[model samples]
Target: MLQFRLIVPADLTDEVAELITSTVGATHLTLLKGAALDPVGDLMTCDVAREAADPLLAGLRGLGLEERGLIAVDSVDMSLSRRSDDAERDAPGDGADAVLWDSMAELTEDESTLTVTYLAFLSVATMLAAYGVMLDSSILIVGAMAVGPEFGPLAGICTGLVIRRKQLVARSAKALVVGFLAAMLVTGAFAALLDLFGLFSRSQFERPHPATQFIWQPTADSFVVALLAGIAGVLSLTSAKSGALVGVAISVTTVPAAANAALALSYTAWHEVLGSAWQLALNLAGIVVAGLVTLLVQKWVWHRQRGRAAATSPPAP
Candidate 1:
């Protein structure tokens, strides 16, 4: 269930109450007269099943409550009331499957921004993968993958495309492009510094890495894995199963590929650089393609389900 709190103009309180009363999966409505001193309005609150939250929120916004007042929604981790149970059972779909699009937009918007911390994480993750490449250590490579923050912009791009938010798409693209370029450049310089101390040598880089050779090798399997991971990653985001993101992170070689490319550039290995660049491009393309498809399907399915439910329901007297 989700909790909605709103400060409503005095004249709109009754309309808000009526809307909540009419909504099938809403319960626990409470109103405090003149409760908002700053907004100078009444306070109205309610609990809504996740499956029914989207329309109810849209209705509230359509009524201008959001502009004239304030609206806030929060997840209810635990609800002991029988009304809560009834609300969830009466809702059109399962809570776990619901997609709060406004919430998702806010989340992806914040995550996709080009922030200093984002750069730091990407650069550090790339540097870590460079070390992993030099030592041919699978564990280190996995750790670097898990640490990388590239997934945010990728997801942002997918969400933006589905929602038709061109500005979001542009912002996310900038972040992805600038973030990778900066990380690779920083990693290349770091590799050069390591070479000064004989830590990273051209011979070691040229040597076949039995444990990590695939990082620079583009193959059909790389695209397949990235596609699967992309589907899982978007599902994790929409379903609120965020722990699955760590698995998505470790399953792809995006960070390692960037690291390998950077290291090759530092050592002037033109052939290895091209291979690693291709590997990077293949994985990113696969993820974006898969993610876009997943989001489009979800949006269509949800709308169809709602349409079916509306059709079958009895008409208002």
Candidate 2:
């Protein structure tokens, strides 16, 4: 369930109350009139089932509450009330399966922002991956994948395409491109420094890396794995089941490919660099395509479910 605290204009109180009362999956409604000093309006609060939250939020936004007042939503980790159970039962769909587009948009919006933290994480992940490739350590490669923050911008791009948010699309694209380039450059310098210290060498990169050979090898399998991972990653994001992301992260070779490219560039291994670059490009393209398709499918399914629910609901008196 989700808890919503809304500040509503005085004149729209009645309409808002009526809307909540009539909403099927809304429960535990409370009102405090003239309680908002800043907004100078009534404070309304309610608990809504996750499945019903999107439409209810849309209705509230349509009333100009977002512009005139505030709408804050938080997840209820534990709602012991029977009314809350009934609300969830009465909702049209399961909470885990529901796609809250507004929430997703907000989440991706924040995650996709290009910041120093993002750059640092990407750079570190790539650097770790460089060591992983040199040492032929699968564990280190997986660790790098888990630490990489590339999925955020990829998800943002997918969400933007589905929601038709052009600014979001542009921002996410810039973040992904710039973040990867910056990470690769930094990792290359790190590899060069390691070489200078006699810790890393071109011979290490040239050695047979049976366990990690996929990083620089672009094939149909690479695209397929990335596509599958992308679908899982987007579902995890939209459904708020973030644990699934760890699996998705490890399944793709994005960080490893970037690291391999960087390491090869440091050694002036043009062939390996080109191959790793191709692998990276292929995986990214596959993930974006797959993520966009997954979101589109979810949006379509939810719209259909809403249509069915509306058809069965009784007409208001």
- Model 2 misplaced stretches (Cα beyond 4 Å): none
Any residue pairs clashing in model 1, and if so which? none
lDDT of 1 at 302: 87
- Residues 237-291, model 2: lDDT tens digits: 9889999999998988899999999888888889889999999999899999999
Model 1, clash count?
A: 0
Among all windows of 10 consecutive residues in model 1, the one with the lowest summed lDDT is 89-98
RMSD of 2: 1.3
Per-model TM-score on C-alpha atoms: 0.96, 0.96
User: What is candidate 1's TM-score against the reference?
Assistant: 0.96
Per-residue accuracy of model 1 over 1-317 as CA lDDT, tens digit each: 89999999999999999999999899999999999997899998999999899889899999999889998999899999999999888777667767888787778889899999999999999999999999999999999999999889999999999888988889899998999999999999999898999898999888889899999888999999999999999999999899999999998989999999999988888888999999999989999999999999988888888777778877877
